[model samples]
Target: MKFRVLVAVSTLALTLGIAGTGAAQAQSIAQALAAAYDHAPDLQSALLSAKSSAEDIVRAESAKRPTIGASLGGNYNWAVGPGAVGPGGTNPTGAFTGSSTFSAGLSYNQTIFDNFATEAQIEAARAGAEAAEYQIRNTEQNVLLDVVQAYMDVMTGQQLVALRQENLTFFRAQLQSAEDRLEVGEGTRIDVAQAEARLAQGEAGYRAAISSLEVSQATFQRLVGAAPRNLSGGHDFSRLIPGTLQSAIAEAETGHPAILLAKAGIRAAQAGSDAAQAAFGPNASVSGQVGTSYSTATGTSSGLSGQLGFQITVPIYAGGALGAGVRKANIEQIRSEVDAMGAYDQVRAAVIAAWSGIQSADAQITAAQAAVSAGQEVLEGVIQERDLGTRTTLEVLNAQAELTTAREGLINASSGKVVATFSLLAAIGRLTAADLGLPVEVKTAVPYTQTVEDVWQELRTVAD
Candidate 1:
């Protein structure tokens, strides 16, 4: 309960940017994930790439839409020579004549038909966009996993630092006790030297532990977008995992971002192949232009000239280029399908690994807990024996070392359990913000795509 109060106070201070001179904010795993989701530059890059790909849809659709453009120009010309003719009449020898003309025009062009080439291109673009969206999800999962690992590292490091400090303090007291006993002739110099050696080792170990913890804190800050605070070491993401390995593998095979991305790739490649084949089909379009021109020499203006025309292009032969393109696209399509199969296999393997990791961590935690309990009793008994002269200083130190090792193992196994559980969640494609039910708005290309695909706008932008 007191810890809860500290957490509240720390969290409030952190929120207000005045967390200094107090206990660190008890940043929860969920909060860290949310912050990382919001701040991940990797995720942002993916989102941007997805939005850029979404523009392809517009580019493809443009093939079927009418386009209008305007032109304006003014031209001046001069002629000189005996044979040069002027706007008024033939120019005299060595005389120069000039004329100015102004013209303005507008042209409208629309695609009448192109077999199904444009349609295939549009489909391909849409698939590409879909693939990019999957990429964003994949990147999000990766960033969140990184944050989880970093957060856990700092949590584990903090505990290790405290353990090492406690060990250091204990060794210092032991050294003092040995010195006191020696002055009273109750202990030998060897005992005092042994205690001093242990104390020196403890000091070095404690310092090394502090250095490691500081490094972990830096990494945590980099990934979570904030310095590590009083992060809670207790996080169980096993609930997010499927009930069994088979179920988890099935989920990943079907729903993993990599699988989805590969599927989209296949679709896009198929569309590209179709587009390449469509090149053999006929294409038709209609275009029109209207313009007015004035001639200063004639002191006359021509009536607005209008012309309209339609064209149909039927490919006869193209030096084998068209066939080659079709073949290449077909090959790409095949590759995409093969890649999809590979993704399925990879995701299944990852699921298996993560599932095994969770079980291993569980077993380690159990064994380490038992070892820690036994180690404490053994260390206590050895210390008592040493004080009674039945055990030497070295023996007591050895017992202490064993207890410390057990405690460290317990800390590591506990941390590994949480990390392993989260790893399993990530492998099963359930590590997303929505999957975790985080409180941040999910970033997606939907808004940008919807706006860009809607009726054309002269200027449009979407706020990040």
Candidate 2:
């Protein structure tokens, strides 16, 4: 009875395991991308960096605003003083102590002029923010490409496993037929042995295919934080390829995130140069303060004071620091120009490569399809001849092997075509989840509330 219970439990566990696997296999590529977009830590970090960069604009602008501040304090004081005595004679007295003193003040300042440095800084900050935004887009593109590739890999692996299993089934049936013929004396013992060997080879291939499929699935799961369930149907690559390489290159030049980022960097460097030049110009400011004080000896008093100031700062003697800064900025601008040129070159190269890959894979697919058809026809003819006793068992086995190879080759060719299509889209900067028609579950910003600029403004107001 104990042994019977153990068998029942084991059977239930096996059934449940298979059921779970089936469930996992039903997830789709769209679902996986959605999950990754929502939860991937790397993407989250990129988004945060973009947000922080945006706050820099506000920080730069804060220099132009008026600031106000207040402070309150109390103090005790002791002092020795000369006192008035009788008959108009002055006398040195003992120490006199004051028990309480209180003071409070409010102050304000405004920047009247600053040689346009503030404006230049704001421009630089805006450029930096734009660069950061491009970086976010670039990171998103990379993530999408990775997810698509991993998802397709899993699908290809699964398809290969299914193909191998089907091939194995055909081989097993053939082996059984050969065995029957041998038992009836219509075939020799060698024929049966050959069939058995083919069956063993097919089984080994099937196992290897299954192992590859498992690894692919694991990779997909690791990327998306969940196993992909029912994937989308086969891709249609007809619409992906551009009519001309020139068109693709043009699109990449205008739309590529990397190129955009480099351009923004150049603009930022220009702004930095402007700011350095502005260091030689003048500045003006205004300040005011109001305060009340209470003391045991002087009683309570209140006063208000205001000052309008205009200060001209000439860069007369900085030991060449300003010139060095300007030189440094010029060098950075040059570097940015080079980087932009490099981006253009990279995009051009990628477009050419992707276009070539697409054309090659398309031709390969056509040839593979024809080969599969020819191989199938050859296999059928050989089998018919064998059944009529005109062909040997070894001939039939060889035909079956040829058919298997043709089918596998066709699958690989199809996969290559699909991959090439996406590569071309990536080269043109058009590879996106939206372009792929993927479903997005959530579209929202990060969780943090107060921006860095907001906090900086509050602190500046207090300081004033």
Candidate 3:
């Protein structure tokens, strides 16, 4: 009885382990996107960069605040005196003494004023943070688009394989019928040979389709960071595509990651310009120091020194460096403006292209669907005629071939429609995992601006 119980427990464990392994292998596209979102090194790097940019605000504010430091040391000295022996003077005297001294002091220097340069720098840092945020959004959009495209490619490839299998099955049935007729002398040998040739061709096509499907699935797995399993058929893309080109362009302008990032660049450059202008203004500072000193041969002494003063730094001479900086900043600002304008044009072009593609794909899908239906009807008629001895096997085979082609065409059209919809969304910067109903962890916004303001307040206190 004990042995039986142990065996039963072991069997249960093995079963559960196998089941878990199967579940792990069967990942959906949505799950893959979630995995990519969590595990992608690039996204993690971008987040770190954003955090680093945020830290820049702290560094900039530090420049306006009082800095405190301390120091300590010890020393030994030896003295020698040479003189003639007369009237309280020694002929030659040499003395050596060692003394240990320690001192610790805290000194503070605060920038009382810096012509708003520090403030401008803080603003620039804020803009940099915003740009980083936009970059993250851009990365997310690109990832989602890639996931969607790869997912659809896999699905379409699988559909093609299925269609090929169906065709092969039909061909095999026809071939069997033709052989039976030929063996009974009801059909000519040519019919049997033709059927055999058609079956061989279909088997080859099926094998090729299967190979293509596997390749597509593998590509999808690599992109999503996991193997895809149990993916449903393609989505209804009609709702995703805008009805009008104007609407599509408007959406792209409003939401496109590239456009937003470019706009952020313009703002950052503007902040830089402001900071450069502030460099020409006056700067003021206040300072304080306190120290305690001890000597081995002398008593310890401690004292505190405080200074409250204001200073204005006027840029008197820089050999044209300041002017050059200002000129460079202005040039950058202009360049950023041009880039932003170019981004807008690019967005518009993408929107228009996607819009046209969606329209064309929709028409193709409709036409393909109609063709598949008509082809299937014709194939049924041909099969009936061949069975009734009114149609030749060759004609029936041709009908089957046409029907297979039509079915494959329909699948391609459907897949094209789905891809075009995603392309449109990506063009507008609105392509995201959430839009596709994929699982992802949404981050809560940190009050970065408020954090910067709090640090600036502390700096003001130090300056005061």
- What tens digits encode model 2's per-residue C-alpha lDDT throughout 335-380? 9999999999997898888788878878887887787678767777
lDDT of each: 0.84, 0.73, 0.73
Off by over 4 Å in 2: 1-32, 79-96, 181-196, 235-241, 306-308, 433-464
Worst 10 residues of 3 by lDDT: 13-22
Clashes of each: 0, 4, 3
Candidate that would win on TM-score: 1
lDDT of 3 by residue, 294-345 (tens): 7766765545544455565688888988888899999999999999999999
Over 4 Å off, model 3 = 1-35, 76-96, 181-197, 234-243, 302-311, 388-390, 433-439, 444-464
- Report the alpha-carbon TM-score of model 2 versus the true structure: 0.80
Native-referenced Cα lDDT, model 2: 0.73
Best by lDDT: 1
Q: Give the candidate order by descending TM-score.
A: 1, 3, 2
Candidate 1, residues 228-328, lDDT tens digits: the string is: 77676545555788898899998888889999999999999999999999999999999999999999999899989999999999999999999999999
Model 2: lDDT of residue 151: 77
lDDT of 2 at 217: 82
